[model samples]
Target: MFTSAIPSLRWLQGFEAVARLGNVTRAAEALFISQSAVSHQIAQLEAHLGQPLFRRVGRGMELTMAGEFLLDTVGKALDHIRSGLGRLDTYLDAQLLTIVCPADIAQGWLQARLHSLQAQLPNLCPVVSVDETARYVDQVDVDVVISRSPLQQAGLTERVLFDDALVAVCTPALAAALAQSPQPGGFICLEGDAMSATVGPHLRQHFAGWSRRGMFDDARLLLDAALRGLGVAVLSRAVASEALAQGRLQCWPGFAPLPNGSLWLAQAQEPRSALIEQVVAHLLSETP
Candidate 1:
């Protein structure tokens, strides 16, 4: 009967992580082990295999041929294990929940709120997926779906994330163009999913000439265009906050403040976990 003279599963895990990350410290951090411990485990594994598994690189490590072979197989095995473990963990933490939200919300808003969620619910991990602007997420994929409002479907639970009013932000030079230009035109731009039509009645009313404006499906792209003084772009404050602070984009006070800028956090009506509320609380809590 053939058996693994390689090493224990723990040592293999350390080896795979260290090999993939190409560094002992980072691998240790990812594997939740001490660097010295990982190093020791690798050495033990190498001794058992009767060959060196790694070679020194510039302040890092690289896998030797044997190490590479083991890593290729072990990496796939570990990934499968992780996926299985994730499922098991979710099952154990049945009260934990997750959601799919706007890309901007995940990167801009929710990102800054994760610490609070961890503080409130220690086992929480918001599985964020950047999807349609107003689309509903599969209940099986995520516990909730966070998106701009004007309910697309009637079903599912909804929590307000706060109105993400569209503020036309541009550089000082662009602002001067808007103020100096005689004609009232949305010649500037506004970015979001092309599907942002589902936002609300107020969005349609305010962005009267959205067709003429620089339309984009991605907020980051529009934010970039606006930064380059392309045109005045109506953007979510959350996504533009950093640039706005840096004086890269200045808000254009040309129109009434958007009142329907509210974003909604939607979950299945019969959710099986408390993860949604935990995620919502973190997402909605004001940032200081």
Candidate 2:
């Protein structure tokens, strides 16, 4: 299955390396080949494409417009190939299920439910990846992803996990003290831009002279600070639900909870197996 229109992968690799490193010697060193071999491959690639992919710029090579276009396309192709190769583990191990989600969601909500999830699927070997910046499942090889917002990518199905709310919570002892005194105190805040904007005005209007004690990008960290009696932490209600239920933390009185974004569970439309479907169902059933 050789396509005459397409250049050899070796030639493309050499071309990409030279374009990136800007020197044939460096590209050869990276590829574990001689400098002449790299140069020869690049020349073959240029001749096959009927264009000069690079031009000599002093000691280094600079890509031509055509080379730039090819580099972009080739880079994406290589990345996709690499991701597919990395996912061979899932194919070899049928019981493995890789789930990716935000760190806060992982620590706050999902951690408590692992035992129950395993009980539902005894053969399941769950691999949870926590990345606060992850917004899409395609960025990695994952069986399912929990996201703050619904993903609109093609070939993906999304299910609503739960609606979230931002609430101010503190230790029960702190709440009792605040109830008696009714004075402004140090506040722990989430560092999200939108959340900070909403919380800043509310704190100023309701609790005048409120000073920030700590700011955390992660809700789990913010909750930890609040539990230590550091300050009143404004975080996702779901993140603090377990602690609140256990009486380790309490919702501060007089402040209404603010509506927040919903969490959505998303997976490929064509799941790898029936077990994945069962796992998804179990998660949905467990959601309140």
Most lDDT-accurate candidate: 2
Candidate 2 — which residues are off by over 4 angstroms?
1-87, 90-92, 132-140, 193-195
Give the per-residue lDDT of model 1 (tens digit) for 1-288: 224664699888888888888899999999887999999999888888888889999989988898888888888988999899888666456655555667776765666567556776776755566766536544455666767764556667666767666676778986776578667545344444334565444456665664355677677777777787777676678777667766777777755555436777776676665666556555666632
lDDT at position 3, candidate 2 = 36
- Model 2 Cα displacement at 204 (Å)? 2.1
Where is the poorest 10-residue window by lDDT in model 1?
Answer: 186-195
lDDT, candidate 2, residue 59? 84
Clashing pairs in 2: none
lDDT of 2 by residue, 1-288 (tens): 223597888998899889888899899999999999999998888888888889999989999998999999987887788798877755447677778877787777776676678876788888888854554554235778898877787789998899988888899888777668766787887777225676667755655687778888767788899999999888888788778878999888777778778989998888877777888888787675
Assess the local accuracy of residue 241 in candidate 1 as a C-alpha lDDT between 0 and 100.
Answer: 66
Per-residue lDDT value at 284 in model 2: 83
> Each model's TM-score?
0.47, 0.63
Question: Every model's Cα RMSD, please?
Answer: 11.2, 9.8
